[model samples]
Target: MKNIIYFFAAALSMLTVKAQDFQGVATYESKTSMEDMKKFSGNNKEITPEMQKMIEERLKPMFEKTFTLTFDRTASTYEEEEKLGAPGDQMAQGFKMMGSLFGGGGKHYKNVKAKTMLQEKDIFGKEFLVSDSLPSIKWVMGSESKKIGNYTCYKATAVVPVDKSNMMNYRPKKGAEEELKKKSEDEMKKTNFMDMVEMPTERTITAWYTPEIPVNQGPANYWGLPGLILEVSDDKTVLLCSKVVLNPKEKSEIKAPKKGEKVTQAEFAEIMAKKMQEMQEMGGGPGSGRRRFGG
Candidate 1:
């Protein structure tokens, strides 16, 4: 009886060690959007200063938001390799030209901000919300599953609708509104102008998660899965986990954003609007130039 009890204890210890030990790479990918400046520029051969300014203003926010959300994740550290440009000859050329024109011969133009969120929760009970800034966009998972190497994977999809609800509180300068009105009218006359409607800008994200790990956390705002997302992708983009080390030598303590002047989502919109107005006045980018300061 004594020998049997000792044997049982040893087996239990081994099981515990296995349950808490895992090491693998997770890859995540997402489909995103970029402004079609080529179309607009093509229609108007002579790009006016105002048109250029408008293009920069519009594309800057969209790019900023997309880049932030696409790379945001709280679990398992990662290192981004190289970012590929949009697929297709025309699109690729357009991006290259734009980069050269705007970036002064750089490969691409991007302003990246790295942020870390401490304490958060997911299906795994508690986690961190480590991600870049992204506007509230929705997506759905698709019905697809497969085995990548040794892991079973599934597909998920979501839609990021074009938000045009005038969420900003800042108004343009005294004469800027008049300029916009004139531009609107001119644009209408030049092209088929229809009332803006909600369209399905769908992004199908497929991921491989394993219930064996039992953690719902994933990169960005994506969660609610049965297990951690090991690999993810959409039609145009792909993010793969390069490496994962579970049960590290030191545990990572997740925390949340606590310093900012806390405000409701609506209030945030208002603040953003006001900030935009201030930027226009100062001839700065639409971004709030202030960083979160401390971690």
Candidate 2:
């Protein structure tokens, strides 16, 4: 066993040195748990058990997705696989709206060497090109090991700040209702968008990477590993690589997105926040002092 491990480690080092000659494609299936969704809907009196089940069934496709990652040595592009669905479908529209908040509906390109990232997003009818530096994640390697396909994978973990608007991180606060009840009407009306629902301030991420592949790339917003990441899990969602094709005959061009109005990551985030505020003001979102939407 020690010899096998050493062999793979040495092979990984060699591949790392010759990474420029490498190219690959990985297919990942991402699924978010519906536990929070069920709890959130349970709070609504108007939504019966049947209605909740129907909603869950309809929204399953949105929460469960497949993405393709194309990568070489220093850069990678990750995007969702297109699926056929009915036009003007309510669930599709819901997915589009939620996608903007969750940073979906985009082609994400990351350049590891340059420490840069470019993402193309379409919100409503407008398109945006989000340009930014790659986020640095501090991963603590673990001794745990497992097999994903024929490759041996090792575990690594990191703690990352949560996106407050992302529903996946949401949980019901123990005393959120009582706390709100104690506040004056004016205070309630002035509640910030994030105050109505509770979510963690940070989340721990677990990733499994295979040294045999020898690439510092992962599915989405995850990298800087010693090898190619095959699986990643954040409390609510899991992204697992289902298929890998290395050095395929046809390699797609890896390039940064060029379309859409250029904006920094911060600028795009501000735009989303403002849009959420607008929705809340119209009583369509949380913090409206009447309706509270949760994950």
Candidate 3:
């Protein structure tokens, strides 16, 4: 009888120790300017009521886009992450078309993976392979804390810098290919836009993270903070944590996408060209007839 009691106590203690220590959801919102649409219509006019309605329908709230990030950090090392559940591919294609029509330069959709060694000299020169490297990023600690579902959350801010070196490679149509080629050569000669261009554009990203989670990682390449980011926001949109399931009944694995071969930014441009050509062929031409419009 004593042995059975000891076994039950040990089992209970093990369950308590193995319980999920960190689990939460993070939200992010981002917006784009609507003024560029005028150029597509070939008229620099104020948005009309009818056009506004159409735009609203196409770009409903969060249509500009929002990201929901869920993290499960029950283990010593974080794991089991999921990204945006929306139709990202279709939306990316739409943005690419819009950019091309407005001379926005380059592809609107880009995916890059790079290894970065974080050397602050304070953390013993620990290095991690960060996902993407964008210029003009600022990490701001916020003075707010709140409970997001079951986990307590804190806030932080980051600014994403715009660098020409980070500009994506988007290929133009056959008719516009010559122009793009010239522009590309010119870009090569000039200083990178990040170095010279001074646009009034700024992306202020506010994130809500939790110290209770004790893991320094977040969705979409943002990490290395004191806690996991549970929410993120920009000037245009807001994402909030909705649901969090910490330790599931079984172990989970977290992995990155492995659809395309790894390539440099230049090689990615070539791939974009081939992809654009395929799309053009499917559509029958550059100014193809409009398809059914529904978000």
Ranking by TM-score: 2, 3, 1
Better of 2 and 3 by lDDT: 2
Best by lDDT: 2
- Model 1 reaches what TM-score against the true structure? 0.42
Error of 3 at 94 (Å): 4.7
For 1-295, candidate 3 gives per-residue lDDT tens digits of: 9668746655653454345553344444434444323222222134566876666556443235444444444212222222343576565455434332222221122122223211000001111122233232458888888877766678888876422222221212234323323444445344222222122334567888866555555544456556666666654344555554445454434334332334443343343344334435554332231342110
Error of 2 at 242 (Å): 0.7
Residue lDDT tens for model 2, 177-250: 55655666566556553556665778899999987888799987799998999999987899999999988889
TM-score of each: 0.42, 0.84, 0.46
Cα lDDT computed for each candidate against the true fold: 0.38, 0.78, 0.42
The worst-scoring run of ten residues by lDDT in candidate 3 lies at 117-126
Residue 240 lDDT in candidate 2 = 96
The positional error of residue 7 in candidate 1, measured at the CA in angstroms, is: 25
lDDT measured at residue 65 in model 2 versus the true structure, 0 to 100: 90
